[model samples]
Target: MIVLAILTGVLTGILSGLLGIGGGAIFVVAAVFFLGVPQHAAQAAAIAAMIPTAIVGVVKHHRNRLIDYRYLPYLAAGIILGGMVGAYVANITADIVLRRLFSAFFALMSIQMFWSSFRQGRKAPAKQQDHDKH
Candidate 1:
């Protein structure tokens, strides 16, 4: 059990680095699927796990000139309010329903990512034409 948890964390870290996306979803999925944690608890755990991972991600990306912090205030404000409401709703929702909803959301995201990968892969390189040819 401990090994599985560590393995999930390592993989989530690698994925977060490669994709530049937060690791919360992966953590939540691993908690629910592998660790047998309830949906609400898994979500709360994911939020807890986000702190260190987020700090590391932000620092690394900022060092590489990738971060634009101007939007942080607005985004953070919305997330804070939304998260409170989300948590309240999740707490009142049944575990089975929450599990189903999580599964459906994950599946949809996976399908969208798979389709987007293929679409992006098939794009031809833009050809540079000689503008001086008159």
Candidate 2:
């Protein structure tokens, strides 16, 4: 179990770094599907596990001058308030409903990503063609 936990953490960290995504996507899915953890518990654990990764990411981005610190307070304020509200809502919601909602969210995101990727692919060829003409 410990080994599995470590492996999951490593994978989650790698995915987070490579994808610029919060670790929740990998962590929650792994915990729920692979580890047989309950959905709500998995989500809570994912949230907890994300803290260190998020801090490290922020530090690295800050060091690279990629972060705009001026907006942090505003972003933090919204995250804090939104998190509180989301937690409250999750707690009150049924497990099945929460699961379905999560699935829907991911599905929508996947569609958007596919659309964006295809759009970029289409533009790339056009840009290359124009460059060749020049």
Candidate 3:
């Protein structure tokens, strides 16, 4: 079980880095489906796990000069406040409702990503032509 959890964390971390996503998406689903954890518990665990992973990511990006420090205060404030609100809401929500909400959120995000990718693909030809004219 420990080994499985570790593997899940490793995979989640890799996906987070590759996709520029918080690991909660991967971690929650993996914990619930693969690890047989309860949905609410899984979400709580994922949120807890993200702290260290996010810190490391931020540090690496900061070192590479990829972060805009100017936005940190605003972003941090929003995150802290939003996290409190979300945690409170989640605690009051039914487990099944939370699960459905999470699933719907992922589905919508996937659709949006596909649509964005398609739009980018459509513009690529025009972009290439403009580049050639330069």
Residue pairs in clash, model 3: none
Candidate 1 local lDDT, 1-134, one digit each (tens): 99999999998888877886668878888888889988889888888888887787689889999977899899999999999999899899999999898889878998999999778656734442233233
In order of TM-score, best first, we have 3, 2, 1
User: Between 1 and 3, whose lDDT is larger?
Assistant: 3
| Candidate 1 vs 2: which has more TM-score | 2
Residue-pair clashes per candidate:
0, 0, 0
Q: How many steric overlaps does candidate 2 have?
A: 0
**Model 2 stretches astray by more than 4 angstroms:** 125-134
RMSD of 3: 3.0
Ten consecutive residues with minimal summed lDDT in candidate 1? 125-134
lDDT of each: 0.84, 0.87, 0.92
Better of 2 and 3 by lDDT: 3
lDDT of 1 at 30: 84
Task: Tell me the tens digit of each residue's lDDT in model 3 across 39-116.
Answer: 999999999897788788779988999998899899999999999999999999999999999999999999999999
Q: Which segments of model 3 are wrong by more than 4 Å? A: 125-134
RMSD of each: 5.4, 3.0, 3.0
Q: How close is candidate 2 to the true structure, as a TM-score?
A: 0.88
